[model samples]
Target: MFYKYETHLHTSEVSLCGHSTGAEMVRAYKRAGYTGIFVTDHFFNGNCTISRKLDWEKQVELLVRGYEKAKAEGKRLGMDVFFGWEYTHNPYGADYLTYNLDKEFLLAYPQLCRLSFKEYSKLVRKNGGLLVHAHPYRTAFYIHYPPNPKVHLVDGVEVNNAGAGSSCNNNHMAWKLARKNPRLIRISGSDIHSTEGAGLAGVAFRYRIKSSRHFVDALRAGDAYLIIDGKITDQEGNPVKEVV
Candidate 1:
């Protein structure tokens, strides 16, 4: 069994995202023959509102609505939709993609509150969600802000990011880390912020992932493939090498 999925797509409604609508994402993913996608928009404590002020509850509400709308559209188009959020950790910042969580959980703990990486990892684990570090090697303003350790505290790392303008050396870094810590999972995604970049990056898992929970479990169990396009394969799965 096999499944093709893109987990880090963005829509225009997101503050920093370009003009890509959820309908456009559905069309693109269907055209690319992808089985599923997770729309993980930016969720920052500082810029949670339209006015760029901290309204954490409103931000979660917006994201929940976005997910519902996208899921409805994807269902109509014969594609699976996964609800997710890209949380921006503050003070020694990092980005984490979390799924299968409720609005209450997000509203309750919108910010990490000076917790160390290890502590934060424990919190995520206790909540039955997965943490994936987003785009660790890009050199833009916010790209290089997150620090990378020889040992990561979370479940996985996103090796490929489509919105990244340069060659992704992050995949190599993630691969080396996964090699060292065999428990770590390496996943790749487009991180698409615009229509043009949607479906441009992804990961193919060898198992038949029927839902969001299955997809997350595949990554947590290290039974997935990372697609960096003409780079290399460090896991098992047939590659669909065309850029979507």
Candidate 2:
């Protein structure tokens, strides 16, 4: 059996742009035939709804509510739940999906939003986590410059962004970029902000991914494939023409 999981998602509890609550999102993924999901709501610096005026501790508390709710539901339903956050690089709209890190880590390093990719890489490595550049080719609305985060700073790249289509996200360009760089693992995400966003993309593994660690390892080992348009596809957007 294959294990399918949504690598990126947002919940209304934390993300101001998200249209569904954490529990609602969880149930949605489950009903859509996913085995798991990563609750990657926006962090304090990004499209978060939380007030920055609050103290750092308070901010972390509110920032994790969505993940916490999803985790609780996941446990009750026997679904795999993982915790991560989509952190935006300050002044740029480019985001990174952080995995294998916990809430305590965020509370301890409240200044994560200010760190450069180099610094962020060091910190994430020290904690044994994976940093994936989310929608690396996306252009910021306020900033005219396109995002070009260094590849060495990230363990993976989102090659197939669900939010990206013909006019938006450079998924085709992103696929070519990752295809050339052998070191960077390729990934896909729905970047789900609403119910309509669910079921657009994810990752599928031949082995059961029992935890966040397994998910990270599977990605690094190139043991996962992209799920798009309700079917498995190659990183270059070609249909596999065979079911997993």
Candidate 3:
């Protein structure tokens, strides 16, 4: 039961991203041998404390269009695609891969600052959604510090984000912090923004996962491995070289 997936990615619809289209991303993932990927574009509120201005509706439209493009390409290439978005928690924290989110849900809840992490997590759970902490170690452009242990919330932590070079170190630190919390699952992603970056980071599941729901369930159930440089391993350092 092995699954190859790149969980975090962006398209041109995201004003900050370099890639122009989701079809391009899917082509890259197909060439890289990825079984699936999550298309997470930037979901920023205009009144956010961070001051980044983005049209919520346009972003949602782009995401939906991207999902369609990626799905069509994936079908031709024999891969799976997941619709997702990167929601900023402002100033120094954010979450990625809010799976199974609808446009109305995003539009209705434009102000993330108004919701507590607990409240937000509940909303996501109530909608059958999943969360992934994106690039916990990168502190340059968007300063994202890891969540405090006392405020234990989130479905999983992304230990490997290829776009952020320091993600490995961040992953290690997150692993240490999350060790005592069995409810918190460990996962990895590419956080890809370009064609070259698409297959750069991912998690190899212990069981084959072919859909977004199955992939999310695997993370929540703690049954996956991180894939880096072709080597697959569990959070505890168990070697899984079959994928390589």
Off by over 4 Å in 2: 166-169, 234-238, 241-244
Best by the TM-score measure: 2
Q: Tens-digit lDDT track for model 2 on 42-91?
A: 98878899998999999999988998898898878777878899977666
- The local distance difference test score of each candidate is 0.66, 0.82, 0.67
lDDT score for candidate 2 against the true structure: 0.82
Off by over 4 Å in 1: 46-56, 110-119, 143-147, 165-167, 230-244
- Which has the greatest lDDT? 2
What pairs collide in candidate 2? none
Candidate 2 vs. true structure, TM-score: 0.92
Query: What is the RMSD, in Å, between candidate 3 and the native fold over all Cα?
Result: 3.7
Q: Give the Å shift of residue 44 in candidate 2.
A: 0.9
